[model samples]
Target: AQRVTQPEKLLSVFKGAPVELKCNYSYSGSPELFWYVQYSRQRLQLLLRHISRESIKGFTADLNKGETSFHLKKPFAQEEDSAMYYCALSRSPGGSYIPTFGRGTSLIVHP
Candidate 1:
């Protein structure tokens, strides 16, 4: 079974400060990792995926298979960046991949 953990339930930081949202996973087989964010009164959206190797909104996450981690990082955080972030893990059991999400971490960027 695959599991994703985002140890912190809430992460608070000031504007213009660096931000790092931790995400760790445990899976026996090859796993796919993704970061999703939901703003107030908005639907959840894909922030980034390990496979994409691309940064979104100045945030980037690299898959470290050795550590079984895919932590999201941003050089500097903005007030508008505050949102509910979720870490997800997916693996093919036989057919399609079913994703398991973390409890979620609320990021608060203070000005």
Candidate 2:
């Protein structure tokens, strides 16, 4: 079953708190994963990718094959970044782009 899973439906906490959004995936071939975020009515944008090994907006995600996870983490969450986060996986080749999205996690950074 090739799929992307985001376990938590809602994760609300105060600003400057540590945050982690869990993501898991199942794929047959080499897995390409990405994390997308939507900030309060804004369009969804790519946050980070496992292959790129980069962090965006103070967020980072790591791909775990054995555990089939790509969890998003941040040491100190900012109030402005409070938004909906989704874990996604792509099955297509060449890393061209197009990922299956999770239900999404709503992160509330309470000021």
Candidate 3:
């Protein structure tokens, strides 16, 4: 079984301040990590994937196998960046990939 955990249910930060959204996972086999964001009145979208190793909208997350963590970080957060962030874990077993999402973290960026 695979599980994703977002310890903080809500994160408040001021504009231009650094932001970190903690995410931890537990799985027996190698799994892929992804960060999804849902803005107000908008559908959920992919923010970043561990396999991509790229930054999107100034947010980046590195998969740490040693610690079983994939924490999302941004140097400067913006008001528009506020959204519901979710950590997801996916693994392909028997040729099927099943993804499990964490109880999303609501990011509130104050002006």
Predicted candidate 2 versus true structure: per-residue lDDT over 1-111, tens digit per residue: 578888899999888999999998888788888888898768988899788999787888888889989999999988987889988888758655566889999988899
lDDT of 3 by residue, 21-111 (tens): 9999999788888999999999999999999999999999999999999999999999999899999999955636888999999999999
* Deviation (Å) of 57 in candidate 2: 1.5
lDDT tens per residue, model 1, 14-47: 9999999999999988888999999999999999
Worst 10 residues of 1 by lDDT: 90-99
Badly placed stretches (over 4 Å) of model 2 are: 92-98
Candidate 3 C-alpha error for residue 105, in Å:
0.3
Considering lDDT, which of the candidate structures 2 and 3 is the better prediction for this target?
3
TM-score per candidate, in order?
A: 0.96, 0.91, 0.96
Among all windows of 10 consecutive residues in model 2, the one with the lowest summed lDDT is: 91-100
Checking candidate 1 for backbone clashes, the offending pairs are none
Order of candidates by lDDT, top first? 3, 1, 2
Stretches off by above 4 angstroms in model 1 are: 92-95
lDDT of 2 at 12: 93
Give the local distance difference test score of model 2.
0.87
